[model samples]
Target: MIVQTLPGRRAFIRENTRLQAPPHTPELSLHLADEVTPIWRLTEEALEEIGLPPPFWAFAWAGGQALARYVLDHPDIVAGRRVVDFATGSGIVAIAAMKAGARRVLATDIDVFCEAAVGLNAEANAVAVDFTDQNLLNAPPPQADVLLAGDICYERPMAEAVMAWLRRGREAGARVLIGDPGRTYFPKDGLEKLAEYQVPTTRELEDLAVKRTSVWTLP
Candidate 1:
């Protein structure tokens, strides 16, 4: 079933976020939350205020920003490939894949409001990205040549689940690429480091203003 966006959700996102270029990847513009705290503090009465899940889509996270920069600079990674940006908060990487000349891009986030957020941001960047809220864990690998994920190792269970799923995608012959800010749970054993970037982020969101982010591919 097509999940229709709730009333005022899209407008609320537009009103709450600011259109700006992320610090690390200025080649593309995105609709992003100017600050994290305000959205973080939103309450249930904030329904018409916004029914978003934690507003992860509001901020241009360091990992996503770094991955986007990599894709923009290295278009060959995704060019002419069908790609999927998993847990695509703010759709930054997905937008970059499309901008980098991917044949098609599907940005999937479990958060319901992220579809609206991704669409709005894609429009701002003049790129096309398909957004979905399906939880793809335990499902068979998607029909994609490339799979991209950023900052997915924050929580232990999620890290385990998504990493297992990503491994399946790799087993199916898709190139699995991930961007991370050195989170503790990031799997250390089987990845090839591709690039690194000093991503500027808010202290309110991350512990530091400049995070050392890296892009890696599965072995």
Candidate 2:
């Protein structure tokens, strides 16, 4: 159960997830875990024993779904631009940006499993997305035309750090966007609302079957 190689991770993902479209972004497909998947039943302790982090990359969270939907619907935002999808779980937003005609996209996450997940999902959607395991927060602001983050404000320290980094990206002239479903730590000010959606999710993941999520950009 300990996945140490890319092939092992890919096999685990293939065995534990199904190729399905998120309810709010049906145009794209991803390898995702549902209630019926074995990964969904793993407890935190179980995951820790297996040397796996929480399988966040295996679920299309409501905020990510909303952001992906908005990107697909507003192609002009990323058309011909370079994009970086922060915390690119399942590579949903990155794929959406590529489908919307972005010249290139780099998907970054700290989880090692996410590299495989993003690769598989991008291949499924017939788009090529670059993946990185480096923690972008440790470096200078990303050099790209657009920066996208989704569902990242669950914890206060992490949310504050990420928001500060995103603000730096905005100051450096990159368009910064975020998608959140009313997370406790998400800042309530200084963002322009772009779109909102009632994204369908599982209770096991969100405690609610549908989440009212919104996409916002730094003004």
Best by lDDT: 2
Cα lDDT of model 2 by residue, 1-219, tens digit: 556778878887888789998889999999988763467455333345554556789889988999999999999999999999999988999999999999999999987689999999999999999989999999877799999999999899999999999999999999998999999999969999998889999887887899999999999
List residue ranges in candidate 1 displaced over 4 A. 1-7, 48-53
Cα lDDT, all candidates: 0.86, 0.89
RMSD (Cα, Å) of model 1: 2.8
lDDT digits (tens) for residues 21-80 of candidate 1:
989989878888777668756523455445444678888888899888999999999999
In angstroms, how far off is 24's CA in candidate 1? 0.6
Query: How far off is residue 54 in model 2, in Å?
Result: 2.4
| Model 1 residue 197 lDDT score | 88
